[model samples]
Target: MMTALLLFWPALAALLVLLVKGQGAKRVAFIAALVEFAIALFAATTFVVAKTAPQFELSVPWVERAGISFSIGMDGISLLMVLLTTFLVPLIVLSSFKHDYKKPNAFYALILFMQTGLIGVFVAQDAFLFYFFWEVALIPVYFISAIWGGARRVAVTFKFFVYTIFGSFFMLAAFIYLYFQTPATGIAPHSSDINAFYQLALDTNTQSWIFWFLFLAFAIKMPVFPFHTWQPDTYTEAPAQATMLLSGIMLKMGIYGVLRWLLPVVPSGASQWLDVVLVLSIIGIIYASVIAIRQRDLKRLIAYSSIAHVGLISAGIFSLTEQGLQGGVIQMLSHGINVVGLFFIIDIIFSRTKTREILSLGGITQTTPALSICFMILMLGSVALPLTNGFVGEFLLLSGVFQYNYVFGAVAGITIILGAVYMLRMFQGVMFGTRSPETEVFADLTFNEKAVLIPLVIMVFWIGLFPSTFLDISEPAVFNLLNIIQKR
Candidate 1:
């Protein structure tokens, strides 16, 4: 099954790299990421060939008395997330080769460690295991930003750490409370199996509070609405490679949590307060989109844009229709790819021009047409232009919302046009106008840069042109999920 391979490869990758000497470390890191990618691909192939129900299943007791086992399984959703994680880590590692960091070994090692934690989160079938992996995933980021970030690294990183941890504490308490309520298993208080968690029945009043506690953790992770204060600073101060990891793959953890944890665990509560969640999500979408229009820094603009998109995704989840949830899942994958591509473009621009301030640059397209073209495609993908990956996901999401409530769908619909405005504004400010002294000396993309981006560009068209390839894979799983929630 390569299930064990999936769990250990990154850790093994990190260990081997640490044994290597200076200058060899980057190569080791890159090779490690590549190997992990291969293993993940092998795992995916195995899943398909076996036609396994909970594909690639592995379960072993980690804490037997507590009914806590190291159980890991992947349906289509987890499989897709693992694919995104594997795909991006290698690119992020490759991107770092050209950049400078103070402690290269530790930096790369942490990246590998972060990969382990991320893969762990998706495959974890237990609640405690999920939270444990979740925290593990953030540790590398905290250190990466604190030790390797820009001028305000400490303050920015600290804020990021504290905000996330604060939210996490509430979740921890909620999980423990739920555990105690689980009929008092003989060997332990209760179990942490996430599937078992779905069976938990609680009053609406209790479910409402519990949902917020758990949802707060994810919302902060997604950085929805008022909880988003930590994102811009953290994104701006961190290195672009780190930012890629944060936005590209890490943010999906929140959406995954919403689908896998929140909706299933508290269906009644989710139904009862869905209107409030819908309002908040729509407001965040519009609010962040407006804020994006004002952003002078390209990274910050993307940061706000990510917030807006996630809010839209969150709204789709609250819609509670099969179509809405399906769209939400599809959007998660598409947005992950689009965001990764955008961050890579931003990193390339920074490398060439030594600036991320959108206002400080102009006429980049004149010298770097390839980079310009790539950026334009990513922008189109971001804005959900027709026949782009973004279009399929947003269309389904909007269709889902429209089916649920026209007023909600109509309000969220503004995001399509608003997104275009901000994305185009950012694109024009950076790529399109007359040449300026700052941009005059910029170089075009290298062979490696194009190599990293081409696959992503192909995916943009592949998904946009034929979304069913991905959508069909998600359908049965989403149906199974909705069926579970509806029955509950």
Candidate 2:
């Protein structure tokens, strides 16, 4: 079925890539990603928004005695996320075309394999399949960073791997517990279906414990607040392309997991702990923004800024309002686009100037107007300038947070100004100050670079100006989720 192919094609492509020799690996990977994107388009275009349940569903028995099933499908929200995944992946691949990583075949193949896991996470209807894909996505990223990353690659990647694995323990436990509790409607006495998970009735106290277990994993993956110590170092040390994957898409897995898996199954537990999550999220916003203001390394600064941005996104989701959930999805997509552009801009700079220290380089604008202009546009998007993608998402998010609690909403809203201060300050410091020998010869954007950036810029305006287009696609699914949560 098309749904199965859409979920698994990237793994197939990764396999095909291993057979290619030399530069052919990049082409095969690029073309494979392109084809995967095209199929994702087909799935999205075919998805009937009117349908409340999953579309293109393909279910089969797996481990029949244990009642596990291999099931996959897409609802409106999952479909939209599928579109984001498929859409960005090809770009992620193309963005790397200019770099000739050693053993290009393995590097590109791992990307494809990761794509397989990402799509699986989004489309999977069975709890076991979802966890399977979740862990599958982690492996390739570990190897990618450890092999191709900076001088501290081994230590940094090892720590990242261990921390993430530790988080997964909680998730695995939650899923197994859910699996045992599921009452079967089919051949098996129990089922691992997500819908069944949503329908469970349990003691409020039990739900609370289950919620924290699942949340620990999601929180650590998003690396929220105190759980976030590992992120900046990993971001700074990983290769630019791998960093893009981590920031642009991988982080979304945590947010998506919370929205889909956590809240639906334990609405009361979510309600019980909602205040705690919000406080941590808001604290992270101020904490990360303040740190971003002081960071000197371009990678580390943006890394901290990401912590700040996603903090607000997390708060919005936990608000548990219709607008809040909708806003979370919008921010997830917008953040994916904007953050990738920001990192790519950094990559372009480092490629040209050989330094990521914001202090070491200056007046890049004096020489590279095109690069500077793109940098400014992405900067504004990050700071959530009106009429940009970030603006639409943040506005909706703030509105949702306000509906939940005005004081926390107002406190969280500080990111608007704080984000701008840090972002523009970083921009002005790097692109507008007196030129140094390091920056005086800075070159303009290359064709390949432009190919990657122009689309991101287009999306910033398109989604900002007409978010309704994107919102409508996911509205049905999101509202359904909120309705379920409120009813519970």
Candidate No. with top TM-score: 2
Q: Each prediction's TM-score against the native?
A: 0.97, 0.98
What tens digits encode model 2's per-residue C-alpha lDDT throughout 198-226?
Answer: 88898899899999999999998887998
Off by over 4 Å in 2: none
Residue 101 Cα positional deviation in candidate 1, in Å, after optimal superposition? 1.4
Cα lDDT of candidate 2 equals 0.90
Give the worst 10-residue stretch by lDDT in candidate 2: 184-193
Per-model C-alpha lDDT, please? 0.86, 0.90
Query: Which residue pairs overlap in candidate 1's backbone?
Result: none
